[model samples]
Target chain A: MRLPNKTCAMGATIARINDGDTVMVGGFGVPGTPMTLIHALVAHGAKNLTIIKNDANEPGMGIDHLLRAGLVKRLITTHLGLNAHAIGLMNAGKIEVEFNAQGILAERIRAGGAGIGAILSDVGIDTELAQGKQIVEVEGKPHLVETALRADVALIHADRADPFGNLGYVATARNFNPVMAMAAKCVIVEAEAVVPLGALPADAVQTPGVFVDHVVALETLTEEYAVVER
Target chain B: MIARAALEIESGMTVNLGIGLPTKVIDHLPSHLEVCLHTENGMSGIGPTLPSDRADRNLIDAGGAYVSTVPGSAFFDSVTSFAMVRSGRLDLTMLGAFEVGANGDLANWKIPGKFSPGVGGGIELAQKARRVVVLTTHTDRAGKPKLKTECSLPLTARGCVARIFTDMAVIDVGPEGFELVETAQGVSSADVAAATGAPLRIPNTALPSF
Candidate 1:
């Protein structure tokens, strides 16, 4: 018995993403951002995108290009402190922005992958984040129901991958990628290195191949993937 | 203020230091002190911040500072990283705040039209940490008090702040409101009271200086 290969060209997979799609981009700053895939998405020119990412990468990098291209219509994220452009767009009402408590965002994505409808928590009960949320009384305490978030496509960056799409993410870069991979209908990954099926140890895999639909091996990591000067 | 706040952290506690002022507290901790430093970006046992030349592209704190991992450091996805925060595994979390109300209500994440960098992990850290302290300037740049009778800005969490370490004094949120814990050297209790927006409860004893 042989496992199927999921390797494919980046452009083709990204091309499948249509306008007005909800796309989950896995990253916490530069570490796990799929820069090459993002660039391909920019060239693919799908407009009115609702992007879910941790942060809008600093100016001229990552999703900023999509924002620059005026492709993003909405962004569901935890923070946008680092990107003035994103804030400007949000402030000007050019794009819609929904902020979540960081952990709740992760839990919502995880719940989506787990086939749950929502999870209750007290993270932001009395705050503005709870303004529109449905509250339920659980064991004498009020809990806000954070709905699960599922995306049409998820873009991931991995340190290593097997032809079967088993992924290994390095250090802090592992954040969001593994979970986002699980929460999307189509999970597309770009890896620093893609080796043979047995190359990545099974136990070391952060994202199993079954969650992935396509894996694109980076020929050379662009400067965007390097250690940021800031 | 940082050096004084460092005293709050005891050995064997897991601490999460917010991005700005609180992050500097790590530098003042004694070398012999052993605490597990957790970063919301999915690392615990955080090591020294590295120079860019020696930095690892894959490793960084939640603030995006290049950091190294200590011996027992472990990495997980965002879900598990936040699970530690929401589950109260974090012993102490020192956050930066725009305002702290007399009742321990914290306002930090949003300043409305002026500044609204959406709340990241702040709500969880403030709401779930075993002890939530704040490290901030006593006053804004315009010289208005940050320890307020009521927060004018939006709150990050309600009744979450335990203590506040400012440049002028150490204040605790007590049942009676902001109580003077200690004063900075050369700073008078009267001066602290004047700087505080809320009525300050100064004890009768001579206040210790940090």
Candidate 2:
């Protein structure tokens, strides 16, 4: 018995994304962002995308390309402080933006991956972020129910991977990648290096191959993955 | 102000410093201080900010600055990173504020149509840290007071701030509202009181200057 190879061409895998699909992009800043997959997505030309990410990256990078292409219709994110273009679009009503407390967003995605309905949290109970959210009393204390956030596809970046799709992320670059891998129906990964099966040590595997659908090895990293000057 | 705020961070405390002024408090910390600094983007035992030429592209703080990791550093996913915050493993968090009310309410994340960049991890950091202190200028660039009787802007959290370190003074929010703890050098209690939007309560004893 042999483990099947999950590695595929990036373009073909990204083509699985459709119009109006809810996509989860894994990254904090430049570190864990799947720039190759994102560029492939831009070339794939999927429109009306609902993007869930930590930040919008900066202008002329990452999801900003999708935003620039007018491919995204909505964004569910933690903050867009660095992206004035994203803010302008949201303010001008070109795109619908839903903000979440950073931790709550992580928990919601984790819940979705764990097959849970929602998690009750006290993090945003008294703030404007709690507005219109269902309030449930737990142990006589009020908590807001943050619903699980599952997506149609998850775009991931890994520092290393095996042909079996086992992943390893480095440093802070590990941010949303591991969890987002579990929450999507189709998990497509772009790895800096794709090692042979059995090459990745068992304990080093941050995300198991079972959670991933496709792994695309990056031949050359673009400047987008470089350390930001600002 | 940063030096004064850095004093509030005691040894062995787990601290998260918000972006902007609060992040600067790290520079004032003594080299031998035993503190574990956390970043919401997924790291603990955060080291110094790195120069771009020598930076590892993979390592960065929540504010997107390239940084290094200290000894005993650990990295995790966003969920576990925030779990430490919401679960109260964090000892203290210093945040920047747009407005801090007399009652300790914080308004920082949003200013409605004028500025709404969205709240990142600020809500949890403000509400769940064991102690929440603020580092801000005494007034906005327009010379308007930010320490207000009540926040006019949308709040990030209610009654969450414990102490405020501003350019003019170090004030604590108590049952009696903004109590003057220390005045900045060359600034008088009257100057701080006049700059504060809320009433400032001065003690009868001479206040120490930071």
Index of the highest-DockQ prediction: 1
User: How do all models score by TM-score?
Assistant: 0.99, 0.99
Give per-residue CA lDDT, model 2, range A1-230, as digits (tens): 87889999987899999999999999998889999899999999999999999999999999999999999999999999999999999999999999999999999999999999999998878788888999999999999999999999999999999988999999999999999999999999999999998999999899999999999999999999998887
User: Residues B1-210, candidate 2, lDDT per residue (tens digit)?
Assistant: 999999999999999999999999989999989999999999999999989999999999999888898889999999999999999999999999999999999999998879999999999999999999999999999999999999999999999999999999999999989999999999999999999999999999998998
Using Cα atoms, each model's DockQ against the true complex is 0.94, 0.92
Q: Candidate 2's chain A scores what TM-score? A: 0.99
Write down the TM-score for model 2: 0.99
**Could you give candidate 1's per-residue lDDT for residues B122-204 as a string of tens digits?**
99999999999999999999999999998989999888899999999999999889999999999999999999999999999
Tens-digit per-residue lDDT, A100-184, candidate 1: 9999999999999999999999889989999988999999999999999999999999999998889999999999999999999
- Please give the CA lDDT of all the candidate structures: 0.94, 0.95
Quote the positional error of residue A7 for candidate 1 in Å. Answer: 0.4
- Report the lDDT of model 1 for residue B62: 96
Model 2 interface root-mean-square deviation: 0.6
